[model samples]
Target: MRPTRAKITDAISAIERCFLRNQDGTNSVKDSTDSLSITEMTELLESLRGSIQRAVSVEQTRKPEFDIFLLTFQRWLLTDIARDQALLCDLLLPILNEALPPSASITPQTAPFVEKTLQFVRDTILRCSVAKDLIGKHMIGRLVATAVCVHASTMLKRQALDILNSLLAKSKENKALLTSHTCLTDLDNLVHLLKNAGDVELQTQLVELLFRICPKPKQERLQFIDTLHLPKIFADIRGDYFHQDCRAFLNQLNAGNDGVLKTPKSFRLSHAECVLGDTTSSLTLNPPDGADSLWLDFNTSSLSILVMIAGGDILSIELAFSKVQRWQVESSAGAFLPMTPIRI
Candidate 1:
């Protein structure tokens, strides 16, 4: 027999009472002295879950009223009284995901409610260890990613990114999930944000987050390379700025001079240079300091010829020719230039 409205309402009331009792410490679920029986709690949770599922399904196409019901359910779940938030989260996640497509036609006022419901779900997952544990095995990541892409706000996008980051930290399997269609699309959007965002602090956090989530081996390298297209999004300095240390590091790398410059052992650049040329002077190279400036009189149609240096030596060479795409140099040393901007 179909569940009556009274029956559903009664079930919801029972769950709400259980939540309230737990919060007031009168009916504590777990107590060293006198704990509530697990069987009783389990039965109540199952009943609540069933009733909520039915209610949401019954109200799915109802628009405004349905939205109100969902919001009520969401608010109740989020409030601390519902100590069994994990159980609610488990039941709600899939329903929310499935409900989204049909609700796409919902009115603007209802849309925010739907989105907020989803956000509540996401936030709950983040806050609850049990919910977080279940996320990798379910569609939570994909669901959150989808919501983020649909919503244009930076705040929502950041929430989505935080969920992904948490998932990645939870397990390797979650990291693999990130590359999936729904997650990847969201990531692409996030990458776009990181590339375009002008805020220094946000960019730094995003870059670091991207670096942390990036897979090891070739995938990590490839992702970093792709990020080069938008280089301005990351912060180059952390503490007191100094260029001398950077110059020294470059000089050490160049002469094959110390352990720091050893191939594959220390950071080394393949080429470095600072070249300047105009339309008339083909590509010409300026010699080292104190030496006659070497002029390459070769005629090239291009207006500019970049100075080239090899073997990753000389602070100046490292500063000038380092890849603008991958590396971000931040130093206050007097020897080297203030900051070298790399594309990657």
Candidate 2:
């Protein structure tokens, strides 16, 4: 049922009165949270989410103030109301949609907005099964892009990398999304990030993500190592790479025919290969068919070769080619490692 204008107005008024109070000339997060019931909070969040999304869709000349509302709303969602999983799922994605500006670049001034986004992913989005695959994981490309955005503050980049690491620790669904075709299409961008990341910790996180999603196929894995061209970086990080968990990760990758770090074979151009990226959306600033960047992606279990064209007057395009090719990927029958999904 459509909400009557009066009903919407009353809900908005109630939300303001409930959440925007200054007692003793100070605003208390606790008081604000306690003022509304879960149901009321859900309703208010939906209403707020709708308004923000409409503003974004319409590309209003004036940017909406959803960012301010989101920071406050997210705090209560993460802490005071953490146990309400349903409300978190219902409200978190829309909050994210509100936080991200359609055409705005991720930069230093965008730190707080990105940080709140990380907090949402850590506390709710990553662990919330309902949001993990279909809704939450889609943030991967955007966050990865932020980690490499030249204009982003070092602080934002580090936090963005940390959020990527956190996403991997949540579940297989999270890990799978990291390797899925939509994400694999962003391989070129990830390549840029891996090469340019200056911070030691940030570099480590990027390396881990890269290796974690290294294609299951031997040839593609070799292609990744060759393309990345950072041969000695990982080897020189002796003390850090030897950590128990890192060692375990390394061991698993090297255990069988699936060894991702194995020496590269000749770079043979093949139709059936995988590259993880989001070129279709990322290359919108340029012109249509501007760059015929060729690569392959695993759209789930299926394989596709794509040439990305950056849109000029129109939006970007992802072109898939039909050609027959085959590469044998060895299936690992090894026992799975003990699971410890951590988030911070």
Candidate 3:
């Protein structure tokens, strides 16, 4: 017979009642189940997993038992029950993926549950070494990246990004694994979200993660950098907190490619100067106080410049350059600031 909602609720309630809050605010299983062996605990989770799988498949949206099930797991995690090997990865990871499938629609009611489930996963991984080990063993890097790059809910995306960062920080191999799994579409989605991201911390973390994965050798980077429109997005979003990272990313990409520079026709040189030493190089454009946009091309090397309304009324532009003999800047808006323009 199919599992009824009442039956699932009763099962979850029974599981929940097995744990009680201690005087120290920590949870512990009641004496009756406290002595349960690892095999018995695993069996209990397996039973709960079967109920959750069946119930969630039957009712994709608004299942109270599902909420209780996650809470029961969360409470269970707070106790010694979670320290056992393979229990978290074996039981929880499947339920996590089921709760937030990549293609599932995230209703407002469902969004909170999704966030809650992801939080549980993150917390489990962070607090339990055994669970962290499962991240690599199970190859769930792609699953976490999908949440970051494909999911619609910002809350869920943020949660997943945190989980991704934690895993990447712990394992060097995961950096390569995740980068290999990420495609052009994933990069495009990440850039799109960063462009519209209102949270400063989110933008910072996302940019840092992008930088970590994107700065490959010329052959590897040229495949996606141009296709994802990263340069255009970088140029467009300057003066935000991540401006330096954006500029540095471009410089890194430019350093790798040896092709001739491609300059747009609308660029007009106002001022360009090349200093020989290793301090830093900057391109300053003074566009008639209220000018809208500016374009410049470094024809000497493989660097192209595209600037938008950075800082809204500030016309000064600064960029770090290396090994370039010439810098050419052009303004379509107004006359240049009279600095000598250099050409390679």
lDDT string for model 3 (1-344, tens) is 55556776786687677766666654454445554456766766666676665544524556677678777766666665457656767776666666565533455555656666677667655676564446654534444554554434656677767776677664656666656645445555666665444333355456666655654466555554566666634433333455444544444434432233331112334444444334476434444445544444333232334444546422434333354444444444445443233333
Candidate 3 displacement at residue 221 in angstroms? 7.8
What tens-digit string does per-residue lDDT give for candidate 2 at 153-246? 6677777777776666545787777666666645666656644443333544666776565554666666656655534223323334433343
Candidate lDDT values, in order: 0.41, 0.48, 0.54
Residue 154 alpha-carbon offset, candidate 3, angstroms: 2.5
Sorted by TM-score (best first), the order is 3, 2, 1
* Residue 6 displacement in candidate 2 (angstroms): 15
Work out how many backbone clashes candidate 1 has: 19
- What candidate 3 gets wrong by more than 4 Å, as runs, is 1-4, 24-36, 54-60, 131-133, 136-151, 181-185, 195-201, 214-229, 232-344
Q: For each candidate, give its TM-score against the true structure.
A: 0.45, 0.49, 0.57
lDDT of candidate 1 over 1-344, digit per residue (tens): 55565765665454434333355655433322222343444554455444444434524433433344454454344443446645544655665554443433334333454456557656654565454546655654454444334443445445545555566674666656655565665566656655343222233345545555554566555654365442321222222432223223223323332212111112222222333322232221344444322211111111112222345232222222222222221122212222222221
| Candidate 1: C-alpha RMSD after superposition | 15.7
Best by TM-score: 3
RMSD of each: 15.7, 18.4, 13.2
Cα displacement (angstroms), candidate 1, residue 207, comes to 3.6
